[model samples]
Target: MTSTTDHTQQPREAEEAREGEGTTGTGPDAGSGAWDDGLIARRAAAASATAGGQPVVPLLPAPHTGTPASGPDGADDDLTARLDALRELTGLSRPRVDAATLAEAGRVLDDAAARRRLSRRHTVVALAGATGSGKSTLFNTLAGVTISDTGVRRPTTSAALACSWTDGAAGLLDRLEIPGRLRRRPVQGPDGPGPLDGLVLIDLPDHDSAAVEHRAQVDRVLAHVDAVIWVVDPEKYGDALLHERYLRPMAGHAEVTFVVLNQVDRLPEDAADQVLDDLRRLLDEDGIALGEHGEPGATVLALSALTGEGVGELRDCLGQLTSERRAAARRIGADLDAAAERLRPAYVPTGRVGLSEEAREEFADRLAEAVGAAAAGQTAERAWRRNAGRACGTPWLRLWRWYEARRTPGTAERPPGGTPGAEATAARQRVEQAVRVVADEAASGLPTPWADAVREAAARGADGLPEALDGLTAPEPAPARPPRPGWWPVAVLAQVSMTLLQVVGGIWLLGQVLGVFTPDLLPPVLLMVAGILGGPCVEYGSRLAARGPARRYGADAERALRDAAAGCGRARVLDPVAAELLRYREVREQYARVLDPVGGDGARGRAGGRHVRVTELSTTGR
Candidate 1:
């Protein structure tokens, strides 16, 4: 039975072999050492020799196996473990690393974790390119099976294909939107060396001619993968559109890249070599290294799945990469870098707050102050009085009151309880107007988007106030509570007195006209008659004038307030802030996974140990 002891012993043995090979300096076995060290030394010597200097150093053989490496890949295991952790935390199947999307995602993950929003997990590798670039072919080759369809058709791949060696990895396929029908058989080598043991390979449609939707599909998947394999063919190898549009811009992702020259069999032998060389040079110019030795370069390989010429070599290279664990960690690092970049806008802490604390407080205070000034209670009472007066007071009583105000000393007229003071009504109006101005000002100076939200909110808040106020201030329709019975006594007396005075005066006037009575009595009689009719007529006209607009004005005010408040309440000030917050949370979670990993006996750890926390380490002291 396989035991923990066996797993532990394997790395020790590998380390010993590496040391031995390093000491032996002579045969094919002499070159083995730290993978990166050997690779760097060889590259340096090669460079020197190419300059026509004395042969600087001989190329060394990479250590075959057996090392105390941390991850499944011979690289950094800590980072890989963290990536896996992050993936699980985020509920995302894998970490995506690509030129177009990596930076944004990296920033988001970092900020999310810093804010304790979510966790992160494993790095996902996706193969993407134009049709006939052999992405499916390469995926099948890497997976060691004929999982994806490959044929002579112009566009062979119709949908995305996903292959993973880890058990229960089927969940990931579902997340990637890969249908079960496309799931392929796993290719197991001797000793159960499963293809893609710890890796998930996603084969996407050709980005060139597939339906626009297919291209969208490819882009969507690429956004989530941890690494990418950009497959290209000889005929279109130097296509400016491909390089300028896809390759050159991706120079930042050199570490997580594998540039494959596929369908090499189609090219003449010498021509193929020339093309490969040119490709390498171009990549170098774009700041992408060509071999595994460079610190920040992609691994380049020529392969033909049709002929199987370079298939095994590529497989072995992948196996070695997986076995080292550092590749996985690097992948996580790359993903973290990308996620951090995406979240930068939100997470970096905008030095200038959109609304300062003092400003917010000031606005709130202004709102409260305006409400106070509106004197709503006073307005309501005044409105109630006005209606009551109109409803209860008789016309005679009103005329008597008006007359008393002008002529009486202690017995001044009152509208039953009394008229509402003008000061209170004016105060109420002032408060309402103040509220409107304050609301408008508070909503101003915000970003257009935010300002719109504030305006909507303010309108909502003020929605019903106008209506409520209008209802209170609306005039009574008619005198529902007519003046008391006593009012009739005053009316009768005034009428009787006026009639007697007119009769006496009219007789005197007739006498004067007949040259019998004095002219004085005639003038008094005429004046009394005019006064009696004029008072009643003026009262009737005044009521008619005040009735119509008083009722309508209150109703209009109510409607206006209702509409404004409704609009204000509906406004959303927090949406933009909340959305940004959520985005930051998502990214921080991803970042955490890259920084810290949870180790378990899961498929994630099969390739190598998890990646080291290089980012944290680098920033730790600072």
Candidate 2:
């Protein structure tokens, strides 16, 4: 039997030895007892960089095994990374995520970290059960001595009792608050050396004790222990408090649990099987997986701790557990799994957040409309045409307009400029509306915390937007009028020539009418008609020639106004929204890393990094 036990344990020990060299010694408890401050800072920096979507090499240490003195590979580094990620995530999602939820996650991390840094050599297994369940008797039976008080008392054990078959468990016992008086070392079994060496078996107070403190003490020990064997009697195997309050909540921790139907010796063989089946059904209802069909799950068996029946099987199971020395790592992994499940919704959203080009273009357009960019462009175009018309019109018309303007001094038309208060108010409202539309689109499908964050970012970016936009619309100082075209002079000269011909023709006609000269009437008549028709034609042709330049001038003004509006929109709204979405994406990816260090799906402890197999520890012992 000893040879067979060693045979079973040697392969695992060899595997652990080979994998032990892979430890990089950068974890929280790496190299020595002292903490690695430099490594902690690097991890913090990496987490900070992750929040900004920056790529960083997270130089985290790998996890060490239960026997840290030997430097085994326990995948402790992944948990540290996850803890850092959680810290970073919580920092980023503050006030958005519920305080209670964050507090729970914090508690889990704190407990796991504390437990991990303590003694890894001893596998602390608690035997927890209700009052008079024979747990104290079982504790003594396993220790091969009367280490715990057990009698007619309703609540046999008030405080925990610890029994170690090996040395180096003082630190662990101290952490458990087990007094020196209650600590013991086991004597040799009938065969010789105890089968369960290196195991720190804790006899916890009755879980359902009438005394509240006893029950509370039971809970405290259960929280810290590496594994638990629930000793239940035949009558109380389906007890509501045991199944409801403890077993169901700890369903994820099946790998570290053993449900023993103690006191089964009182039942007949056939009846015992029926009772065991019923107990299995109850555990299944509590969501605890059973290791019955060669699967990795909780171990369930019949054992009469008082009669010594089936006690050997239980010892064999525990011996396998202690020999493997992975109980601490397994329990920590299960704790991490529970914490990650609670935090999943906050970190992992339905889909990713993104900002598309179409949304950007639309936002810009809206902003331009809010500022009346197109209207300004049209006004500029018309102004250019009117100015050109005045510059290129006939001299006679110019003289008439000048005389009229002098008569009505204040009636001259002004350029399209000057933003009114009412118009600015309307424009401000439009700008705000445009901002809301884009912010909503960017935040869609994100969780409440991240969506809230995106909105806050947009708000901050747009805080001074309306004022900035108001400044953009303020009329620019009138520029020096552009130099006129050389053709203006030629057109003016042609008009002047037409006026001279008309003047000379009129004088000749007058002379003929007065009978002072007998010039040919047909020549004078022809000259008069040509001068009259030619002057108007030249003015009309000039107006038409200026149309192309006037249109281009208008287009340039429109483009400038729209471009200015678009730039303001991009600065105030688009950029910030895009940035928020990017941050969410990066943080979300970091969250994925926390959930699975290998950067994929499944429970963090099971799917990623080097971790104790859930079924391997529990099922192997059975």
Candidate 3:
């Protein structure tokens, strides 16, 4: 390695020599202003000896940003609480989201918990970049020691190397899985204290490594770090893989990010400036923030680890950041935001879903038909009429009806409705169809899982309903035999009188024939005619009275069937479906709580310290 002093002094010597003489000398010191191999080696050696056991020189000064060092604060406590709440709430949403998504979020929560528990005192920051990006060199230079090996190997930084400026970070490093040998304590120069007092710096493997394990390692650690420094060299500054793969996806992590164009000393002064501007443009296109005039988005720095060009400026920025010590919270907050965004779809609004009246009524109608309720009701009406006729009609007619009832098939025997045949089959089909309709209706506005559950519930309800329906026999006294009217007895007496009148008429006629008359023959004949006519009128009145009871009987039977169908529908279909819907409602409400921003007064600012709100999901399930 060429020392900075030697390389810079060579150019100065040339300018002086050229000004002093018209001809330049071709020697080791002034040959085209390039240092010879011997001179470079000697300078390197002299520099090492000149250190005199002293620590590396400090160029960057502490920033005056007044950001506090990492310490216990109510804000962090509140943020942790909010994070716990978020994790718990997400668990409740397990039924709605896929297993993969839930597992991923669970990992995030677990990592956050572990990191928080390990050490909130040390802000873990990592330097990550593509191969040959000078990230390892920068890390070693930052620590002012050779902890991570640097070389021309394809991937020099194989494993993560950590450097901590403060104590109590050993536990944290162990958790990161960084071996103790690769860990180093930063040089605390004679300047009393450095700006990165409680900082823990890491050099991670190249992000786009050909080796899968290397890339996996990068991903694993990136999730746990408090902040990141993206080291990009001049040659690969505009690489889309860098921006598209890592930078763009981490848009929410801008506040805790630094985009440094490492090895900028390789380029000329003007070229370096152009590269910086162009890189910022690329980052902008990548949606990685470039804070307004370096306020606090992605702080861009142009630094050279070998020459220490912009290292001081980067140190100053990081110094301010470390002083504030909000990177851990900011990083964790950004992660939670990402998780919430990913979970957005499950909570999409669909409003409310339920069974419509028309659907329920249709379902009941189908079941009613399946069970032959209508036929049974009509049968009941006929049975009532027969019974009423027997109780209130003339004795001769009653005897004839009794004989007829005995001959009738299935009279108060099996199912009141004759049999389960074509009508029953058709009814069963209709019942199944009705179940589908009700299920579809109830599931209309619900999410996919809930809708399926409702349909299942409806099917279950239909399955057990057929037999229950067919077995419903109309309630007994299976007949509606009304009491005999008072007029019935009077009619009986009148009939007797009529019979007597007829007998008298016959006797008188006979007497007349025999030449002896007891009463007038005309009067006896008139009486007989009246008695016969009145008897028919009384019997007709009794028949009319029986009609009302018969109709009521039919109604009662139909009602009983309906009650049975409704009970089946509720137990099998409605109740189960309702339970599923209620579960959905409960989860939806939990998601609603998830949607609400954790309204802590000062415990948490917006993620990235930008005034941004998470997109709240509508409850309508659109």
Where is model 3 poorest over a 10-residue stretch in terms of lDDT? Answer: 14-23
**lDDT assessment of candidate 2:** 0.70
TM-score of candidate 3 versus the correct structure, residues matched by position:
0.70
Taking the tens digit of each residue's C-alpha lDDT, what string does model 1 give over 1-622? 0011111111221211110111112211222333222333344445456445544433322223223243333333343233333433233211212224333443333422221111112235778887678778778777777888888887788788877655555654665678888766568767664444566678888878647888878766765455678888987877776677666655545556788899899988998899999889877666554444433356788888778878788777666554443443344354444443342332222222243445444433433333332333334334544543443344456667678767967773233322455544553464355345544454343323333444455445454544443344345574455233334345445545545665666676778888886556548667557646754544454445444444454445444444443333223222333232233233333344443333223223322111232232223210
Task: Point out where model 2 deviates above 4 Å.
Answer: 1-77, 91-99, 189-195, 412-419, 483-552, 600-622
Task: Give the per-residue lDDT of model 3 (tens digit) for 534-559.
Answer: 55565677578767867887999888
- Per-residue CA lDDT of model 2 for 484-549, tens digit only, reads 676877877888888788888889998999999796798777788888888889889988887787
Query: Which candidate comes out best when scored by TM-score?
Result: 2
As a TM-score, model 1 comes out at: 0.40
Instruction: Give the clashing residue pairs of candidate 3, or none.
Output: 67-323, 348-621, 349-619, 349-620, 349-621, 349-622, 350-620, 350-621, 351-620
> Local distance difference test, per candidate?
0.49, 0.70, 0.64
lDDT of 1: 0.49
The segments of candidate 3 whose C-alpha lies over 4 angstroms from its true place after superposition are 1-98, 145-153, 191-193, 263-297, 301-313, 344-351, 356-358, 381-424, 456-463, 471-553, 597-618
Candidate 1 off by > 4 Å: 1-107, 110-124, 194-196, 292-296, 325-329, 339-622
- Score candidate 3 by lDDT: 0.64
Better of 1 and 2 by lDDT: 2
Alpha carbon deviation, residue 82, candidate 2 (Å): 3.0
The better candidate by TM-score, 1 or 3, is 3
